[model samples]
Target: MTPTAPDRLVLVGGTIHDPATGRDGVIDDIWIEGGSIVARPTDPSSFRQIDCRGLVVMPGGVDLHSHVVGPKVGFGRRVAPHLARSPGKPAAVPTIHATGAAYAALGYTTVFDAAIATSAAALAHLELADLPILDKGIYLLAADDVAVLNALDRGDACETERLVSDAVRAGRGWAVKVANPGGAVFWRKGRGDHHDLDAAIPGHDLTPRRLLERLADAVQAIRLPHPLHVHTANLGLPGNWRTLLETMRSLDGRRAHLAHVQFHSYSGGDLDEGSFGSGVAPLVEFFNAHDSLTLDVGQILFGETVAMTGDSAAAEHLAHTTGVPWVSHDLHLSGGCGVLPIAYKEKSLIHAWQWAIGLEWFLCATDPWRVALTTDHPNGAHFTAYPHLMALLGDAAFRRAAFDRIHPAVRKRSPLKDLDREYSLQELCIVTRAAPARIAGLPQKGHLGPTADADLTLYRPDRDLARMFSVPAKVFKRGVLVAEDGHVRATPTGGTLAAS
Candidate 1:
């Protein structure tokens, strides 16, 4: 169904918190006309007005990374049937319709599925089309194609750029993603564990390091709105922060995005318990010094969630260690993904450490604009977990109480105990809405400026930050009321946003 805008709408007397536009809690009136924020109409009676006194307004939320659809998500839904039906449990993998309604009700208006294989672009789009009330797109797994890898191997940089461009255009992709680059070659050869950023592919001379650098260059050369989206090698392993640092250094100041960075920043070596701690300090230092890099902290909130990714090796390692029922599929030579259910326990040592690491990155990062908030959705926790995570970040006492509940050893070793920085409303706005949209290259999103998309959320201000964000008073998508008070009111069809 086509999404039609209301004739005219006015949100009067709300404190607007559009950080991108530098309007920090300014009590103002917003005018909407023909699906876009516009100047106030000459005749005040021409617009239908909504009373927003004492309300806080901002642009609709934008989630930069999530696993919302496609074959891997389907696999997760199939494997975890109980998640969808359990009385007290939120589904680990929700149905397409539920994903749309959940995000809309949460006041989000834009989302990007972080990894979609180039070969399955059509299937992913079909699933995304059913996702209503938000503009959506996918990052193509362009580096998984052997032809593209071969181009990199032969030093045919120009041809490689062409292949990357052609794939993005053909797939209608928003960005290029390299998930554990060259790890597939290792996986197929039964040595997936041996491959690192510097390790060579089985039959090709191309290394994951070079794969990252070259792909990043191609993405910049294409001048796409977003840079290359990278899920670097050595995710979820002990002492993998070095790999992350190396991945960063290889770019040599070229722009790239590191996905699920929390998983990569661990201090331990050789999977040992004593060594497992927060590696975020050094990583955060490197991150702070580099302006060309951006990341989404795939925070791990303690609960049951599905871990799915194009990085089959990481999944394989996780499945082996946790002894969970896991699923993997190789799409010929294109690439593959893995899915498994994981439950993080507060008393468990590693889980506690992981929880601390994620928060450490969030608190330590100097710039909110460069680090967006994500639970990696269903991977770290559910997208619904955002409210709870926000509460943890915005309320220092809440974070301390939760930290004290975790494993005792984690309290002694982790850096979270010493951190007291609490995020302000403006900084929270930057991380959740403004930063993500800007990182995803959606210019018209994440702000309520004139001529921007009229996707806005209005909230009744409360001292509880989580409550303030969780149940918005009203949500408008493209100038149409889509949700109110934590319920989806309109199931309007959403359009696909792609880069050509």
Candidate 2:
């Protein structure tokens, strides 16, 4: 399904919020031609003009980190069939068609599946073909390959770089991702407690730190648009903040993107519930001082959702603790992934802290451009819950009201209670659009600047931030009207963005 050429048009009199071009809420006209934003023509009568008076316009949304496709996602849908049975609503892990329709209706035009094994990339791409309306890409889990790991173990930097580069090219991936480096190897050998980054993998000379450093160097050498996408060791474990910090420090000034830092930022040791608390302060302090690092807060909203990850050890631990039915698969020596249903309750001490810790990361951070907003998709909450999360960030009063309902101990101990920072719409645009596009190396997708892809959304202003963001009044994908008033008007075949 090839996309037809888009018409030349002018969107007139809209309040634009393109952070990339620094057009912050300015009333202006946007010109589009051949699916890209263009300079106004000298013969203005040749273009079709659409009146956009009283509407707020911004570039389409880009989700830098998410798990919207793959075998793990398929298992997520199977494990929770009831989540999809609700009529007129999307499942937490939606069908391929529903995933794109839901995203487009929410004004998103670009998304990347955060983790896909090199072995599974072809299947994922096939699934992505049926996913319409948003341009998509995947980060290949290249480090999981036994050959690549052997190269790292032998300290063959050239071989390591060549293998990673080959994997990215062969898989048609947008970037390289490492999930709990050496985690699957340990899991296969039934040694799941190797949380120390310096500990050597069984039968391998390389430590997690070395594996991470070598991979980060390879990603840089390959010159892919995004840096190494990392899901560090000891995720969802007590006192994992130390591991997260060590992982960042191990980079040694090399660039890397941390996935779902909220899961890593936690205090306490050995499941001591009383000592468990927010460890965001130290992590945030280090992150603020380092420009080489960027992260997404996998913010957990209280509700039922599925947790899926490339870290089988973390998923197994979670399943064991909850005693819930879970699905885990080993992609023969390449990697493994786990999927299970999860429920975050307000009264649960751990869940409450998770909620607060995520907000703490958001409030403590100084730069919106270095941060991306994600729920880890169904892992934290459904992508549809994004508008609700936006409201929490933009409305201090709303945030406080929700904060008061969580566990009393978390309220007493968490710093979120004292924080009053609220994200302005301009900043919101940066995190959701401009920053993600810049970080993901999709220069043309996130902004409405001249020569950029004509992916933009318009909303009717409302005092309620969530309501205003939940459904855009109009959505344009590559200058074609794809959705309007929460319904998809056109099903254009969106292209797959990949690194050469």
lDDT per residue (tens digit) for residues 1-500 in model 2: 34457999999999999998889989999999999999878888989999999999999999999998888899999998887776765788998998999999999999999989899999899999999989999999999898999999998999998998899999999999999999988888898569789889989989999999999998999899999999999999889999999998998599999999999999988754658888899899999999999999999999888999999899999999999999987745377588999999999999999999999999999999999999999999999999999999999999999999999999998999999999999998988999999888887978988889999999998879999999899999999999999988898999998899
For residues 158-240, write the lDDT of model 1, one tens digit per residue: 99999999998898889988888888778878884553587788898888888888888888988989999989888898888
lDDT of the structure predicted as candidate 1: 0.88
Instruction: Give the 10-residue window scoring lowest on summed lDDT in candidate 2.
Output: 328-337
Q: How accurate locally is residue 116 in candidate 1, as Cα lDDT from 0 to 100?
A: 88
Q: What residue runs in model 1 are displaced by over 4 Å at the alpha carbon?
A: 1-4, 192-195, 270-273, 331-333
Task: Tell me each candidate's TM-score.
Answer: 0.98, 0.98
**How many pairs in model 1 have backbone atoms within 3 A of each other, for residues 3 or more apart or on separate chains, i.e. clashes?**
0
What do the candidate models score in CA lDDT, each in turn?
0.88, 0.92
Identify the runs in model 2 with alpha carbons over 4 angstroms from their true place: 1-4, 87-89, 270-274, 331-333
Using lDDT as the measure, the top candidate is 2
